[model samples]
Target: MLKELEKEWTENDRRDEVASQDRPVPWTLLASLAALPIAAGLFVGGFFWWRGRPARGALSEEIAGLSMVSPWVIGFMAFTAFPIFLSLALSFCRWSSLTTLDHAQFVGWDNFRSLFGKDTTFYHALKATALYALLTVPTGQLAALIAAMLLNRESKWIGIFRSIWYLPGVLAGVGMSVMWRWVFHHEHGLFKTLIDPMMPAGWHFPAVFEKDAETWGVPAFAFINLWTIGGTMMIYLAGLKGIPKDLYEAAEIDGALGWKRFRNVTLPMLSPVLFFNFIIAIIASFQVFTQAYVMTGGGPGHATRFYVVYLYNQAFDFHEIGYSSAMAWLLLLIILGLTLLVMKGTKRFVYYEALKA
Candidate 1:
């Protein structure tokens, strides 16, 4: 009886030991594992739900959308908005690398007075830039229009000719400048060869390399701009292609031909396209820097001193960051004002058939 009791106790002890070895997991750890993915899912769902919520005002919607694109908004604020405001502030104060923020004194409109009232170079640069624009815009647009008309003709191998004309415009800037430099080379230049023989005795061509060439005020840069208009011509060509052939045929049937057909049908039809191209061309021409920089370096007595180039010199060369900032703002305002003026003027001229009564 004692042996049987002892055997029963041993079996019971063995069963309890085995049960303890296979222990159940802790409730805390099990709950944590279950909650992890559920918590993650809830967070993800809440983020998307917050993004698509309705807003109270237009500005609120804008802000919400901007929040969704917060990275870009942050970037714009840091890079563009902050810089502009800082510039405006800087323009009103005198600063230097050695000077701390406390050292910057309020100068009021002294900088503006210097730029407009005292600095003769500012007016000269403005005039040069304006002249460049006036010469380039009208001539380039006319040339492009003429080239487009010629290309629009339904003839064999016209595509080949169009491509040939546009090749110069597509050439790399350095390569184009180098090529143009050769073409305008005074001693062995093509223009020299063509024009020198036509002149009377004791007269040489107006040399851009020579001193006092600015006073001559010739259109040497104008021709360079004209040569670059090949690209613009191609864009105009594309615009011309969109005009229906039926319209031209209908005009021809109504006794429209030559200049009359062009004036009545082509011009009216192409007015919208012309307006768009005109604005683009004007904006581009006003920002003309590469050719002048590469070729002239604002030399020949600062004849080709473009606004952007001057601004660049002020910012980087002279370290007049504040002054440069002011110039940039001025440029922005001028461009904005001009664009608005052009749009207003174009309203009376540009015709759209879709919008017509």
Candidate 2:
């Protein structure tokens, strides 16, 4: 019995020995792991402190400058940067604005594919917007330049005239649209009440906001947009004022008359301002929404259905927020490409040093 008990005790000791080999990790090792990051951080802080010791005063001023700009930095990160990145991410998602982001599903290129393949409204909106940009940019700039030329002279009434021209620019966008509605109101409008009677028999004014909208709607909007170019006119006026009078005098001496002086001297010198105006105007033209939204509500059919209006409809009207996000990115890419192309194509024409057009 004593021998058997000794053997059993020996067997228990062997099992315990084996269990000790599989013991929990050492506290020392865990403590070292926890301290490693703190040690590294301290080392980095010490190095930077030592390096900046000589320029401590400069370093403080830099910190102060950063402190002053921190609010703006924070605001941009919160408002602009976050939304931009979120929109980009959401473009790849099948998510509605009405739903929580947690509900988002990953759908790779389906949104973009639908945009290019199946959506007819997207194509119509794109085409209309492209045409509007093409028609308006050149004509609008020309009109603004002419208005500037007319107002660029010395006169007692110059301030009043300029104020008159620029007042329309500051008018509230919605108010302007409302006023235009009255002006184009089929029956009691400026055209219908006054000019329709003076027309030849069987002739009638075009219902640009309604029945004849498909034919004349975009052009009507383009014409109305002329009044808003007062700001552009003022810019052109400033550019005109900057042109060296000597250039015009030299042209005149070389038998260049009024038109010749304008063509040879004025246009070339004003090319920089022209370039600036073109870029701003083309962007504004593509993003045209308020007038189309208010005046005709994108109208009887897709007549005045501009790109942004259609995008807005897709988002709010149809609740295709993800699709709308895709459209937004697509428009951004298109505008960016067009801008690059224009910049490249007009590199020779945009005279920083007044090269002849």
Leading candidate by TM-score: 2
**In angstroms, what RMSD does candidate 2 have relative to the true structure?**
18.7
Misplaced by over 4 Å in model 2 are 1-54, 354-357
Give the CA lDDT, 0 to 100, for residue 169 in model 1: 78
**lDDT for residue 123 in candidate 2, whole number 0-100:** 77
Residues 268-302, candidate 2, lDDT per residue (tens digit)? Answer: 89999999899999888999999989988776677
Question: How does model 2 fare in lDDT?
Answer: 0.80
Report every candidate's CA lDDT. Answer: 0.69, 0.80
Task: Give the candidate number with the greatest lDDT.
Answer: 2
Q: Write the per-residue lDDT of candidate 1 for residues 276-295, one digit (tens) a residue.
A: 88888878866777777677
The Cα error of candidate 2 at residue 5, in Å, is: 92
